[model samples]
Target: MILLIPAYEPDDRLIALVTSIRTAAPDVHILIVDDGSGGAYGAVFDGARGLGATVIGHQANRGKGAALKSGFRHAGRTHPGEAIVCADCDGQHDVDDILRVADRVRTARTSMVLGARQFSGRVPVRSRFGNAVTRLLVRLATRLSLQDTQTGLRGYPASMVAWLQTVDGDRFEYELNLLLHATGAGYAVEEVEIATIYLEGNASSHFRPVADSVRIYAPLLRFLLSSLGAFVVDTAALLVLVALTGALLPAVVGARVLSSTVNFLVNRTLVFARGTDKPVRTAAAQYWLLAGVLLAANYGLLLVLTQLGLGLLPAKVLTEAALWVTGYQVQRRFVFAPPRASAVERPVAEPSRALGADVR
Candidate 1:
């Protein structure tokens, strides 16, 4: 197993972590990526190197994702088919927990092992809130019940390194993207509980709360905005057509036709196109088929609600809201799914033991 640490302008905590790991598991190979730490941090890298870690340097500071990709590339070339466990250099992850995750990866060679932290005692407020929100969003998006969506300690078998390099994002968002795509790429997620350590209230972390949060939530946010735009177009057209013709059915059909076209175009070209290889024609056909079913459901629901004494506008809003989740799921899983790949049979390994209860 190879331990990959991605460090950018790290302090002595990195050296301490390396030393502890070297002491704990002398045979485990340690690979550190100096993500453009520059000449000032030379002593720190040298100190880690002195402890027998192979250091790879970048000319300038790339993001954490880039640093990880560099490490993955190095591991692919040097230690092919070896399990790699990635831990943060901020001294947040315990050496023992890292080793446990590594062991899990070794047993479940096709699974992504995550060292999940239980935020039970004395956690930083920002860290707690961030993980809570991200965990919820990740669960909603990918249907994966992850306790720690933002944990930096993760393990991947060597087979996933090439695919990891292709995942988008150059910052913290990259890690979340990995979780979002893991199952779809035929990798099972296994969690090993780990201690939650926040040294100096996590001051060593380089994550920018506002900027990185935006990047992390960009995919969902973009889809939301696109849906909102389409809703606006649909509502406006419905009201206008209803006013001109004094007919509800024609207005609904015309509005849906217009909005569906706009939505399909936006979703196909922008929202759900990343990492997907489905042809435009195929996606459009599938989208329209789903859209037609949704339109029928939308009109039926709207009609029933209006007949049951709700205002036309209120009923339209309720109907659309009810169908929103279905539309998003169909578009995501069917209309814009990644190219179909043969299923790889995963060996069913014994369940990993949970060391602690999940706090979030």
Candidate 2:
């Protein structure tokens, strides 16, 4: 097993963590990627190197995602088929918890094991609030109940290294995208409860609350915006077509054709993007199948409401409002599901006593 830590402008805590990890898990290969922490932090990286960790450094700072990708590439070339345990260097993760995550990685080599943090007891207000919002968004977007969407302690299988290298984002958004697209990559996700420690309200952390939050939420926000734009187009076309033709069926058909085309184009290009190994035919077929079902149900509902004395405009509003959530859910699950790859599962290794030792 290998432990990969990405460090930037780190302090003595990094040095201590490296020294302790070396003492506790001598056989575990440690790679510390110095993410452009300048000459002032050179001694700390050197100290980590002296303590038996292999330190890799660059002259300028890239974001955490870039740093992690560097580590993944290095591990892919060097270790080839070894599980990697990733932990934060800001002392939020203890050595024992790191090993615990590492052990889980061994057993779940075909899966991504997340060290889910329990946000309790004197946690920073921003961290707690940020996590709460992100958790809700993830649930709404993917229907996956993830306790910690912002956890830094995670384990990756060797099989996933190539995919990770290909993932987008150079900073915080990269991690969120990884979780969002994990299912598409055909990797099962397992979460293990772990300790949450915020040092001085997580002062050493480099996350920008406002800017980073926007980036993290960009994908979901774009989806919503796209849907809203389509809704406006659909509603306007329906009203205009009704005014012009003075007929209910013609208005509905004409309006729907325009709206559906707009929706499909926006979703295909922006929302449920198609840039993967998964063939477009599958998603296209599924999407049209869903559209057909929704169209029938929508027209049926409109007729029923109109026959029961509702006006055409009111019926259109009610029918569409009913199908809104259903459309979103179907598109997300069927049209945007992650592509899965064939994996060769490796055997689980027993935990070493050295790795299991408690070291704070």
Candidate 3:
């Protein structure tokens, strides 16, 4: 497997990181994407070359996304059969985890793998809230649960490079953009728990939560409008069902199932269909997953809002809005992101592991 490390004006810490990687995985190919660090820092990379690392230089600073693209292109040319793992150059990821993901990559064909971090250790408040909010948005988009939206440490099949080349968007939004593209293509994305080494409490971190989040939330924002319409359809159907049957639970559940299905269909075609190859069965499976979750979220929210004294009508209104936003996020991250072709070119014709389940 090949590991792509994108760096800009990398410090001594990054040098140490490369050295550590060398010690951990001697055979692993390391590509350092130098985003216009200039001649002043060329020698630092020179040191890396001496340590047995392959350095790919960019004459100018491109965003993180561009750097990753460069690395993917390099890997495609140099190591076609190897898995591609993307890790940040900020030294926040453990080298051990890189090796671990590499091991999984051998078996995880046709699936995108994520390295999930433990949030219990001094997570920034803004980070926690942002992740929670974004996680919900991703869930709604793709019908999958992702613990971290901005994680830079990830692995994917090499074919993803060709798939992502079809999409646009650079800068910090690149990774999230990749995820959206991948999930849209019907590829499964699953997370592997890993340790995060946040040195000195992330003193060198460059993440701007608010700004980056706006970029990350781009897919979700578009999906939200569609989901809102779905909610209205659900509400109207629910009221009609209640009028006919006077059965709140069954009526609400039926209406929600119908509405969420509309949402899933729209999302599948409009939002995610742009780059998906998920087998028809994969879509059906994901649809069922999405339906179950939507029922739980929408119904659960209504129940809680009623208990909180918001009353049924007002509560339904508020709850519906909340659930739509929540559902959109999940779908983006899990259902339609990081674009890749199904392991089999025609997954619908013959369902296989490449269809029903992600190779995670």
Q: Give each model a TM-score.
A: 0.86, 0.83, 0.67
Off by over 4 Å in 2: 240-253, 272-286, 297-360
User: How far does residue 238 in candidate 3 sit from its true spot (Å)?
Assistant: 14
The parts of candidate 3 lying over 4 Å away from their true place are 225-360
Off by over 4 Å in 1: 241-251, 273-277, 303-309, 337-360
Models ranked on lDDT: 1, 2, 3
Report lDDT per candidate: 0.83, 0.80, 0.71
lDDT of 3 by residue, 1-360 (tens): 777887777778778888898888878888777766777887777887788777776667667777677667666666777788889877888888877777777677778888888677777677677768877766655566788767888888766655544455557887777666565565678788888567677767766667776777766666766767886898789889989998778988889778877877777777666525666567667667877877777778877887788866788888766665455555654565433444344231221222111111
lDDT: worst 10-residue window of model 2: 351-360
**Best-matching candidate per lDDT:** 1
By TM-score, is 1 or 2 better?
1
Over the stretch 145-219, how does candidate 1's per-residue lDDT look in tens digits? 988888999999877876777676888889988887777677788889999999988888898999999999888
What lDDT does candidate 3 reach at residue 190? Answer: 75
* Candidate 1, run of 10 with poorest lDDT: 351-360
lDDT of 1: 0.83
lDDT of 2 by residue, 74-114 (tens): 77777889999999898999888898989889988679999
